[model samples]
Target: MDALLILSGIVVAIIGWLWLVITSLRLPVGKLLLAALLPVLTLFRRDQGYARAPRLLLTAGCLTLLVGLAMLFHLHPHRFEKLVTGQWQPDQNRSQTIDGEIMGQRFRPERVFWRGDDLVLEEGPSERVRRSLKIRFAGAGALLDDASIALLPNDPGAWPEVIMQWHVGALESPGLRRVTGQYSLNLDFAPAANSGATLRLHLTLPSQHQTWITGEARLDQTPAWLEQVRQQQSRSTAVRERTATAPRQSGERPVARWQAISVLAVLDEPSVVGDAAVRVTTVSGRAHEGRFKGVTDEGRIVLAQAHGPNQVDLQFHPVDIRLLETFQSPR
Candidate 1:
């Protein structure tokens, strides 16, 4: 459907341009030929009278000329370039990445920004959830501005969601144009399971042309170790409360109580450091797997060092409310 819409739009634009040229150029040779051909063709077909034939043929010829010009000049070259290159190059000094977790699962790439290119995200990994992504102001052009990226879940009945937005510059010249925009990924995951996700990238140019690409990856799985730590913390907390309330027996050195409390607190702390195990995937499809240990604070997980070629320092934040709720809920 999208392809059809785009094709139709291009056709219409070309026709409009042809009309403009027909009126402005007013080529007598072309006009005369069209005027004569129309009446003859109409007479043979036994259709309309000779009068209307000339006007209809003239209109069609003009439209054809406009389309020819558009095709020859390729009004929107950037869009075509993207289709061939499959890479978006926005202006310099514009780059960003949005990171957040989906239900405590993993720090997924929520959005990526590079100048004016707005890359939309889509559903790719699991089937349990849907995500919408949008990117605004994809690339610079002569007269085009304002671009967007949208992601729809696999469910055919579901509606599309906007995930990114940015302003595009107008298309005016033929020189190298640049655009910058942010790519944002938005997902609504199922309560306790990992859901699949996808990202869609789009680049639009001045000539009303666009290029689309897609990338996909699974959300990181929550480490079972984290769950164990939480459970231990809960038990320790309960033990402390009971001990605190049980009025310390006459002089029973409060040392015992303090010892127990310390043990409990330690049990609840996460042992993984940014230097623990780390997994890295490069654009070349090569997997460099290692480990890195790091510390987490205020729901943000950060890596401190890389254990190998596949490991790198990265930060992740909890963004999945449902996952957090389930994790905290009594099992």
Candidate 2:
């Protein structure tokens, strides 16, 4: 992707230069004369077998000159000044910070570190947010944007939660916003323990809002993932139990009570109410099932009485939505 983008940029630049040469006399005539002389000089070097080195050098010089001129006219003065002065400010659109520890598996057992800074944007009652981070591995050079990310409402009353999707090549160097890089493995908060494994993480959140939680974590016990699963299972089990005991009403079929069920997966999709679904499965063995209702005030699935002695009410937490989606998908 990087090569393709660079190639495309060069092509566009060449085309633009051709257009300018055809239409304008302002092309730096001195630079153009020097560019024109390089190839002629190459032809005189017969001992070098008329090697194309001169042409390559001339082409590079021409391209650099064109790009320099373009930047003079197109680049922002203030931004250029910052670049020259070696000082830059973080974009201040919206603000939030996340700090956390990240651990990964490896022989000789080592840990990776994580830190992030994010911008938040508000649209009337809604909010839009973006984040960037730096991550370091034990033996590897530092990697940025190593996943531990979340967007919560800065407004204490809302306490809204939104998980940002990880995209490769999202982090930017602090000195040059344009210099961006990619992340190799994007991980969420999940705990796992294994032989030949170790974990390390260091994170920084850039906002004034207080972060909800932070501490040492393993891949196996990611609190958010686990808590969400637990809530979904509890909700599903409660619904099943109520349905099992509910007496059948006239012309009504009793809902089946699922057995030894566990949440298998979840997905969050855009919705009028909210975006997410919870997928569940039985511990004994069976295909996964889905629960489509939104979360309740207490963070459980919302359920209504359908008839019989089993009818009950319920709600679920944000995690259930992801579990529901995964379970519903094949495998």
Candidate 3:
């Protein structure tokens, strides 16, 4: 019945369109003007039963033509070209812009790839240098509720790999959604890999569904970029160290917590330094103050007491961490 109703509507729309075109071409100018205004007069005419059929058809035809035009333009053909072709042909040296409509909203990407879990996009040019942006996805397994991406430092010299958090929904159930708390890229942790080096992203769900996706850089290998950043950091650190070593006339110097943590994480272990410590408060209101040991295999942080003889190791996931603060500059 539904199919039949749809077919009937299509036929009526086609007929109405044809009638409009035929009348516009064949009818005299005076008659064409009268036909266009006849529908408006029908609303006021009380005894007009004979003109009702033509009036209704003309109005319906106009509305259908407007709707058809909207649909044709709204669903842009160029945007879905990559989807239909199943390949991303982007420039090797520079980033490419990929555009599409997802969930009725237009999504444009600085770089593009059809990963296993979702359609991956580099949101901006800054991702090439900073590597600090969430990958947007809207395909396969589930719809994304929210997502955040960050680079986690593994080795001081090596490029930090990508880590992400996604609030995703089940494909089978519309409203049933869960957050993949924190899933880091399960890629080869090599700093010397090329910009186009391939990496894999595996995000597992409570339903035992593991979404694996592939990624590649548009320009500048991870190792090279990090090496350049590290060189600049070293120069900056030297200046800061010189400033610190200089005698102060009156007041004490203040430390920037985040900068200290990042610098220490790159140069040495935060636990090894006497003054370096990070205090992280969890989502459940529990606070843990300790030296930053490192990120675990499961993407959790290893926090150890800075001064205790018998070290207590506390494992906290990225999702659980509410705030992170560093005590002082690295020794």
Candidate 4:
């Protein structure tokens, strides 16, 4: 029934278009094009006799087109909703980002987004990106629930955990699979002049074979309420807390705590220095310029040299530093 109405509508609309064009051929070039667009314009022809049949046919075609569309909506009431909200194509949302591994086949994905609702990661050519990873919240997950994109939990302790469903692999390669397991998002929503944030995506998909969907993606977001979140954070007298996974056994590498790097030194503090470009001269008389990452829990100075997106942290003991100088001229 649906197909029939659609086909009929197509046929009638075309017939009306052709009928108008055929009668306007002898007219001027402008009139010919005008008649093609507005078939009803043919009714104004000085010769009422020639315009009679085409005018009636055009009316019938228009009515058929409207009726067909009406019936289609009646049959599929959700049609209108889908047109407004449904994704017709993978990148149909205009904004797209991808990161992480899809069934261990691992490739590049645009990783420039952050959201708690319908967070999609796309990788590979257009088609496979969506086939790679999808993350969605079963409940309202946002610091500012009304924020543009769901702002990651600002409480520092509030984590949105869910049984996430991910399309782990492609159908042909390694056979398509689904991993349904515990998952959570850890976001560091520090105040910045930019629209991106650092986040850690933790997933337990069982077997640990591609346990995590896609590589760790830097999910960036811009919410109008970000400044509000920053303000609220500023008012609260609490330091952001970090959680360790478990007690480290032996050779297992420790999970790095995802923390915001804030300036530890003001011009007033002449003793300690951090969070800016600086030259560090060691007691061994070796000097290097690097940016400061916060000290590790074990009291090691974390100096980092940034190369594009990656930062290489060179650690040092506080006592070994001979002097520290900032690129800024002293005021």
Top lDDT model: 4
Please, what are the lDDT tens digits per residue for candidate 2 over residues 101-178? 212101111122232221111111113112222332222211111122222223111111222221112232212121
- Tell me the whole-model lDDT of each prediction, alpha carbons only: 0.33, 0.32, 0.41, 0.48
lDDT by residue for model 1 (283-303), tens: 322122233333344544333
After superposing candidate 2 on the true structure, give the runs of residues whose Cα lies further than 4 Å from its correct spot: 1-130, 133-159, 162-191, 195-331
User: How much does each candidate deviate from the true structure in C-alpha RMSD?
Assistant: 18.7, 17.8, 17.1, 17.1
lDDT of 3 by residue, 1-331 (tens): 3233334555665565445445455556665554454534433544533244554674565555555444433443332333346545754554443333223233344554434334344433443211112343322111111111222223111122223322112122221223323433322212224443232233222223233333333323333333454455467558757765777566655534343234324234434444457776656443445676776666666665522223334556567677666665534
- Full candidate order by TM-score, most accurate first: 4, 3, 1, 2
For model 2, give the 10-residue run with minimal summed lDDT: 101-110
| lDDT (tens digit, per residue) of candidate 4 on 213-249 | 4234444565445556555544431332222434667
Model 2 alpha-carbon miss at residue 103, Å: 28
Runs of candidate 4 with Cα error greater than 4 angstroms are 1-100, 126-130, 138-185, 191-193, 213-220, 224-228, 237-331
Q: Clashing residue pairs, candidate 3? A: none
